[model samples]
Target: MLRRYQTAICDALASVDGGSFCEDMWTRGRSGGGGCSRVLQDSTVLEKGGVNVSAVHGTLPPDAVTKMTCHGHHDLPAADGEGLQFYAAGLSMVIHPRNPMAPTVHLNYRFFQIFRRAPSERSGTNECGGEEATEGESLLWWFGGGADLSPSYVFEEDCVFFHEKLREQCDRCDPLYYARFKRWCDAYFRNHHRNEGRGIGGIFFDDLNENMTVSPEKFFAFAEDGLQTFIDA
Candidate 1:
């Protein structure tokens, strides 16, 4: 799914700018997995931009598990015990248009799963020297993502249009999603030291799962619509 998102977004941008993206593939080594990054520079419509996708798996350190627990993932195992293994996949993109009048846009959508390794698996290593916990049973999973615009100079009409389109997209899934995520976007993008928001808000959400009153399939659909919204906007 993430790969599909990356391809769609990159293709849309390339079509708009009439420029091709250079692809770069990278590996995570012992951590397992790799990803591809597509970047375009000095394009007709865009100054610079990249759409990236990655799927990585590895053990999370004790401190990382503690942080997740503190963030309300109480179901996670205790951090004092063996490290929890995890798998994460995501698509992220940022576009900087050649024209300053156009806003720099950013979008990211990701899925994460946590697992506990069996005792036998924990004691072994894979061919790559990474832990042999690839077959561990998943204990928790979630989806997270957001999209926002940041113009060098604010254009009220443009900002309003962007927010309205995002709101419309959110409404298709759940009427409450727009308001809730709008507030989250405004709050999340704020610069505490400067006491100002980074940009005119669009929509933001995180840690979304079945507990949030939506199934994983529903969330995936919403995320897919979000990418379409970005392309349209």
Candidate 2:
């Protein structure tokens, strides 16, 4: 399971630069499995933040699939008399600052599964995808991860720098990708009920597969590198 690998990731990250930062842990029960959430804060740099890791598994009920409707992409398994088996593990984080000028950051990286690939699943055929590609293979065996920034105050330079770093990673695979996903990032982060975004946007991307230029290993490397940039920024 990815749970063991994810725990190793957290340990490696924390043992390195994150050790000095303040830490916290959080957990909750789920119909299937629970989650572990962690946080590291620096009084001078961040007001409060969390690095959460969750290991959860179970059949995704219909209500669960409906919740993702907002994403405009849903390809869950057929409702057989039996339930689907699924497992997921990953890290997510959010930083809210006392000083609004510095900007707030959010990040999430997750992996998921389904019993197996269903031939009838939609292929994510939208022409607007950040990376141009084909479909047929399952999106279920995949990883989704991205980091974004929202500043109460706009800092064009900071925004540009942030986007550029992410762009550098995406550009290595596809030049058009970074720009495409940047727009996606801006559109996805709104608090629709409130009719406002969390902050002036940074960048966000998800559902990346090994088929993408950034292979699983490379994706993690880029993600880790991006986290360092976020800290330094």
lDDT of 2 by residue, 1-233 (tens): 23343345445445543443333333333233455555556545456666666655545565555554346445554444544445565667776766778777787767665543222332332211111122233435566777787788898988788777778866775577677777877788878999987666656677666444445666665556555555444
lDDT of 1 by residue, 1-233 (tens): 66667778888888989999998877687546667889999989999999988876777889999999999999887854668888777889999999999899999988888878733334354322244444577678898899999999998989889899998999999899999999999999999999999888778899888574556789888888888888787
> What's the C-alpha lDDT at position 167 in model 1?
89
Output the number of the TM-score-best candidate: 1
Give the backbone clash total of model 1: 0
Residue pairs with clashing backbones, model 1: none
For all predictions, the C-alpha RMSD in Å is: 4.1, 9.5
My TM-score estimates for the predictions, one after another, are 0.87, 0.63
The C-alpha stretches of model 2 lying farther than 4 A from their native spots are 1-35, 40-45, 62-77, 116-139, 191-198, 210-233
Off by over 4 Å in 1: 79-81, 118-135, 210-214
Model 2 TM-score, 2 decimals? 0.63
